[model samples]
Target: MSGVQTPSIDFDAFIFDLDGTLLDTADDLGGALNRVLADANVAPVAEHIYRPAASNGANALLEAGFGDKWPELEQLALRQQLLDYYAEDIAVHSKCFTGIEQLLIALEQNNIKWGIMTNKPGFLTEPLVQAIPSLSNAQAVVSGDTLSVAKPSPDPLLHTAEILEVDPSRCLYIGDAERDIQAAKAANMYSATALWGYIPSVDAALGWQADFNWHSPIDGFNHI
Candidate 1:
């Protein structure tokens, strides 16, 4: 007699990191950073220098670019300038990664609810999500400033799941950074490492220990 094969489990919900995972906003962010630096009479940092740290938020960019000489007040002012510039040009060089649109469409068609859990500030995060035609209907959105604590703390991820009315265990979180994995694990959710997103000089395997790793958005559909 032949035995029957088991069917793979399908996730009920999906959660994503915004900056590096879903959208490639580094170019737009870098442009804003350069503008801020120039307006402050400081030399601009190279694109590569700012790309890897883009997910860390505007403060990290300001610190990395002007920490040595600028006083706290000046740094805050510059950060505001960068934020203003980014809001107007959020989509200038920013776009969804290749195959991501298809993956998202597939998920929606399969009845898999998805939302965003990003450390990006709400002001920018909300507008960017609204601007993206594909992401306009996300189930929920949790921004860094949405709560007292952000990613790597599990607060944002947990909060997202709560709002989506899904259990953390039923959600599959995808991200490109170690902090994203840390947040997912802390929330007791399944996590996938996005190999196509920015990894800088760090190895995702060693740093994140993600449940699964994929080279592209289409590759992720297989794991899901």
Candidate 2:
């Protein structure tokens, strides 16, 4: 992608989605679910196949892994099992996306505040962020339970804006999923899609109406 066609749009703060945007947590998440699959005698799915589902967290991963292996009640049990397994090794296979550290440092150097807004539950999101030292000083962090609603509803993004003390219109929300763009739109914030992140083959962010579609972390920083 050529990044955002419009450089006129500007923001004072930046908000990022955790899983597929700011952090490359796919390996850890997929590994965790595989542990559950192993216990159930179901073969593990390849990491690449599980990457897209990471944005949706445990529910999507469990559904993708189990498929028709079990019913709804059993899926719930297996989801918890997946979470339990993940919590035990939250950062074992997780890392910031390439060039993301340098991008974040550039943001800080510019005195532009940045934070995380994710649908991932607090139990998982907090520990994952804590595990990454570079993410420790996030201006704010709004997890799924932080508000009455998560992404695609606008509440979480709006709440995070409040926490950052920035007007929603002056903030840029970036993520690798459609729901993230949808939420940003509803909140009247500028939106961008991280094309370098985990996106499903069937999905495309080009039509997501983002102000920018960046192919890499540092590529996005230039626009900011």
Candidate 3:
């Protein structure tokens, strides 16, 4: 049944995108965005509507709240307000996705190193990761602030592979965004798209061009 001894890859390391890929963090992010909208006396966005935008970061989330008003509104000020509010309640409703704990355990049992690589600033990413036991002890963490250039540049992913002491070719990277796929390809790493991550309802995962696509943590983890 093992048939032709299927070509297999022993991924030495796994790197993940923080927000939508690893954690269900929409609540805190959406919550903060709504607060900022309220301060502007605008109607708050429904949580379900903002969930997808949350994964894209503060700028996108803020734009969702601002809507047409975004053009005339000052993005920087609103983004700061959103960030400030988010900092106040970082991990309130955040938690690992279902099966992630099992995946992490499996990785550990197999002696595969796992880490985080996200565009979120280190200041915010560090505390958030620390608050979650499973996330805090990653083998390496390459945050947006860790380097001047961010993802889609491949620098962060390459940096992470170096820090983990694994060849880029031996690492598997999972993320929810298209940039994640681009970075992985550029770094010559395997790319797996986390289909369950917070992709906007208007977007399609087909365009990401990842090596493989997994709809849930179990599916993705098992694929590796």
State which candidate has the highest lDDT.
3
Summarize candidate 3's per-residue lDDT along 53-143 as a digit string, tens digits: 9778898898888888888988888888889999989999999998888888888888899999999998889889999998766999989
Q: Model 3 residue 112 lDDT?
A: 93
Per-residue error at 117 for model 1, in Å?
0.7
- Which pairs clash inside model 2? none
* lDDT of each residue in 161-184, candidate 2, tens digit only: 899999998898899989998898
True-structure lDDT of candidate 3:
0.85
Ordering by lDDT: 3, 2, 1
RMSD of each: 4.9, 2.4, 3.6
Task: List runs of model 1 lying over 4 Å from the truth.
Answer: 1-9, 70-73, 202-205
Q: Judge candidate 2 at residue 49 and give its lDDT.
A: 66
